[model samples]
Target: MASLNVGGLGGYLREQRRTAQLSLRQLADAAGVSNPYLSQIERGLRKPSAEILQQIAKALRISAETLYVQAGILDERDRGEVETRGVILADPTLDERQKQVLLQIYESFRKGNGYGADDGPAGEGGTSSAGTADAS
Candidate 1:
């Protein structure tokens, strides 16, 4: 797992906020926090609690686990998979809604069957067992 300190966490939060296209004030409003507090968090001047992180993740429409990992509240279980998620989150082509949906589906598959890169729902050809593109 990456050793993410307050600075790293703050950077990660800033990146996510930018990716979501939300101003600090807007995110603070959505997360029920003060704008100054959110600013402090993003500037590495404050360490928010797990509850606050959860709230921020909700407001960002991202997985709370992702924030938890970045905040060092939880150790990353799978570095490769987590990196994949980071790529997905950081993809400039995909919109926030698309990214969120892809992340949700990926996480569900991981939790449901302990899937890895080699054991994805789709096979090597990138097609489902039903011989069609998997919409879900």
Candidate 2:
């Protein structure tokens, strides 16, 4: 996914915090970040890394991938795949190698069924970057 500067992500974080009935200071403390830093993030004056976003998401009890999508760290079209990968990566029982192997299997299955990395889910009218039908 193409990385973008923070703007919508900041606003979205603010909304999520409010919806969770949390104040900036409360969320900052819960997320183990400084209040000022979190305020800067909410004001769009800062870009949070994926780790920081994950901490904030945990504090808000929301999906980290949602913030990742808002921050442009992950593409909306790839949200589901990325989410599955995230869950696999975060599993306590799976070792690194197992996680990687599982991910590879998942990728192969998707590609085998005409859902390659570049292709959307079925019935999405897969198109190439050039805006043409998928040649393969």
Candidate 3:
């Protein structure tokens, strides 16, 4: 079955923040939240309500709807397929290569004819799908 990680949204946000090189205080200021609270959320020690999530999303310049879906606050349209993949790939335990692998599989699965069953096999049955593979 397709799965999602409810905890991933926080980590993803944290990564984005870091990529933007914004300090917690700066992000919090931009998002209009307390630094401590934003820190807690980044560390996965706290969860934000939808309204707060929207604010954070705005600060991150991403869609709140996308954040909700990643946070597991919203169900994925493809029977949780997208959410599930995001959760797994978002895991902090994964290295960059692993994350890339997961993303490849997810993209292939998403575009495949059958998601799970009649669905076509993952790109290489265990390999990352670089370009050139039929998305179908």
Q: What is each predicted model's overall lDDT from 0 to 1?
A: 0.78, 0.84, 0.71
| TM-score winner between candidates 1 and 2 | 2
> Which ranges in model 3 have alpha carbons more than 4 Å from their true place?
1-6, 78-136
> What is the lDDT ranking, best to worst?
2, 1, 3
* lDDT string, candidate 1, 25-131, tens digits: 99999999999999999988998988999999999998877888888876565445767788999999999999999987776666454344434344433333333
lDDT digits (tens) for residues 1-136 of candidate 2 = 5676598888899999999999999999999999999999999999899999999999999998889889998878888987888899999999999998888778776765657676776667653333322333
lDDT of 1: 0.78
Q: Whose lDDT is higher: candidate 2's or candidate 3's? A: 2
- Over the stretch 1-136, how does candidate 3's per-residue lDDT look in tens digits? 2333536877898888988888889999999999999988887778788899989888988767687777776655543565566678779999989887777766666554333422333453433333444553
lDDT of 3: 0.71
Error at 1, model 2, angstroms: 3.2
lDDT-wise, the better of 1 and 2 is 2
In TM-score terms, candidate 3 sits at 0.52
Give TM-scores for every candidate, taking all chains together and pairing residue i with residue i. Answer: 0.55, 0.71, 0.52
Cα-based lDDT at residue 115, candidate 2? 71
Winner by TM-score between candidate 3 and candidate 2: 2
Predictions ranked by TM-score, top down?
A: 2, 1, 3
In model 3, pairs of residues that clash are 3-84, 4-84, 114-119
